[model samples]
Target: MKAGDRIRTVLLAGGSGTRLWPLSRRHCPKQFIRLLDETLFQQAYRRARLHSSPDEIVIVTGSAYEFLVKNQIEELGEEVLHDQVLLEPCGRNTLPAIAWGMRRFADDPDHPVVVYPTDHLIGDGMAPVVLQSVPLAEECLVTFGVVPDRPHTGYGYIKPGDALQNGYRVAAFHEKPDSASAEQHIRDGALWNAGIFLMTPRLFFEECQKYAPEIAEASLPGEYSLLPSISVDYGLLERSGRVAVVPLTVPWSDLGTFAALHDASRQDQFNNVGDAHLFDTSGCTFIHPEGKRVAAVGVSDLVVIDTDDALLVCSSGATERVREVVEELDALHDPTVLEHRLVYRPWGSYLVLEESRFFKIKRITVKPGASLSLQQHHHRSEHWVVVSGCANVWIDGETRLLPQGESTFVRAGAVHRLENRGQIPLEMIEVQIGEYLAEDDIVRFDDRYGR
Candidate 1:
């Protein structure tokens, strides 16, 4: 915008959601997973485009997911600029994340910044309604509230005080209520805090100064770790008197849990979603996205999720307990809960086909013009066979260009690197022979990805 346009969008894609895990993990978040034709992050980007220009939208994610964010945006056929994506060093809740976004307008503190959590499943039509409320953001901290369709205990509630410009003043803010409190809030005309906000940095910082001075002072990413991890709701919105709530009449779901995903997704007459051969299953959600067929019999209101390495089966409405399951897995130090068999990197991705005590096999793909770190393993020697495309291999001081069906070997303690210089992706199968065949056995002499 030229000066005084008063609108910029911030997309919070750094969040790791385990509620829809196996598909959504620490390495691959909910925003990157494709439950439909497009990912939820892409949907949020499209919604942002309806109101602001591509230049006006700022994407905030962690350093680990930087490539996932960029690659997915490119898959949409649009090139994302390097400066457009902000890499937060760590997860410190929405308060610091929002502060990180609004800080972009240090000189233009009066400019309104609209924030959206990318995990939300919002309909396309809601963009126009959001555009209509941009003017209200100048004077009040605007929060887009979803009118409660049902008594959902997971979300925080907001009670409207009085009528404002096409919205209402926030009378009270309620924390995540229980079953009884949620029903009472629903009956009292409270809105579910959709976690969407529109406000200028001036107003936001002023509220932060009053409510959370440490957060206000700790604006830079390096100082972000020092601030207490808190949501914008607890730190600012509830205490700020200059807050307003706009009822979002759009079809929306936070998609925070598998049960919510099932509710929002398309279902058959039996109310079933996903790949499953069912005989007597109704209101059960089974996800077999890998094209594997699963059989279900005489089960209702159950959630059966099957990934290559993990399977989750639980009651439908009790999907919130998946977090507890994750905690238990973490307590056991199981790596399966953190990532899938396939892990994404800036260059491409690698899938572990098989692993044993003495041997491991992996299928690795390198994007064109991308290269892995110049590194070597201490306890393992790797044999690489090119399956397709061309590979530029560097072992020790020797470098050679290998084509499809060619093979190469890198002895243990020898510096080696793999690069794809061809137009197509270089696909290769790697077999490792070692006593300790672990990922941490690598010692990088050099890396372009800053690992």
Candidate 2:
């Protein structure tokens, strides 16, 4: 691809993915979940990099997922340019995110843009299809239309007109259809709208201004509004006339639900899927907690998800309604539905082992050579017990090295820091007692991970 013709890739990564609930919570969403060897967002990044340079790739994610996105991208061992990660204070869905990304690239008139959702699984060679469609993006807004393998009612359908040189013009766009209509659509050569879009930034904004003036006006404030909580398809794609579809015969799965995940994943002879330990089980999807075992017995077509603090058991077919359950829990202000037991930090992770009204127990893991910020708590005192590796602990003005099985105390309002000077991962158990045990009680003096 020519540098002048190169298309900048925008990854929309802000969804909470409530459908994959229990395993995918609000704090640590589905994009960060490891499907194969890497997370879904990482796969999207890698795929984007296959067609565009690192500098040309941009990620738009929620403020809460900013650290998770940064850490995952950084772990790829590439120098990620600053500001490439745009943080949204909250999610306003794809249109606002795409609008923000378009505004960022609108500075360069020559650069085309491709907007893709992060939590999709696509074939390896689909990058060339995106690259090939960039030249024609000026005439028509291009979307990848996956050839329907089955009559999938969960996906939108695209009716194709006469074939162009590289693809076909989209005659009509259909929302998720009923089973009979979906089957008829498959028979009538309707393609699955894969949510893969390619267009020039100028063209995109112009079309938004022309057709979706509300969204265009929303973009003018330079920030997304909380109102109009709708998706891009309902707001733009259904109303736009200048749209084209490129048929791709690739092995792809959205993996948006447990049934889809099970269908996309490999299964053993007993038809059990995932890395979880399955015993005496047939046709089960058991997703285990990381570094833990999830053993099932005499189960079939069951979806068992094991997290540190919560466990979910449901039929695979009922997974699509999991978000409703999560929503009900959220309505009740349930913390388990909001945050996972293991919270990912930029430096490492901390898992909650136990908690009470006045005390909390946590298992903290610091990566090699990583350190926590020099900070003080207002209402809490902590007792740190080194579990596996060496820990360089700083309390008030005193600094000491604590090996495995050693312990230290940090009083409330006293400055403290923890570091892993050793080559191995630092594991420690932290017990806190206080009037308040919330995460916002910390006052940071210095942070290496940019907090």
Candidate 2 C-alpha lDDT tens digits along 1-451: 3424556899999888888888788898888978677998988998888767888888888888888898898888777788888888767778777887777787874567888899888878788888788766877788889999889889999999988758888888888999999999988899998998988777787778887677776743354665456676777777787788899898888888989889888999988897766677878887876677556667788988877777788987788888888989999998887788889997799999999999999999999999999999999999999999999988888989999999999999999999998999999999999999999999999998777
Query: Distance (Å) between predicted and true CA of 88, model 1?
Result: 2.2
Model 1 gets an lDDT of 0.87
lDDT of 1 by residue, 88-165 (tens): 888888989899888876678877788999999987677666666767887799998998898999999999989988
What residue runs in model 2 are displaced by over 4 Å at the alpha carbon?
A: 1-6, 217-222, 275-281, 290-298, 388-390, 401-405, 420-424, 445-451
RMSD of each: 1.9, 2.7
Q: Which 10-residue span in candidate 1 carries the lowest summed lDDT? A: 1-10
For model 1 the TM-score comes to 0.96
Model 1 deviation from native, Cα RMSD in Å: 1.9
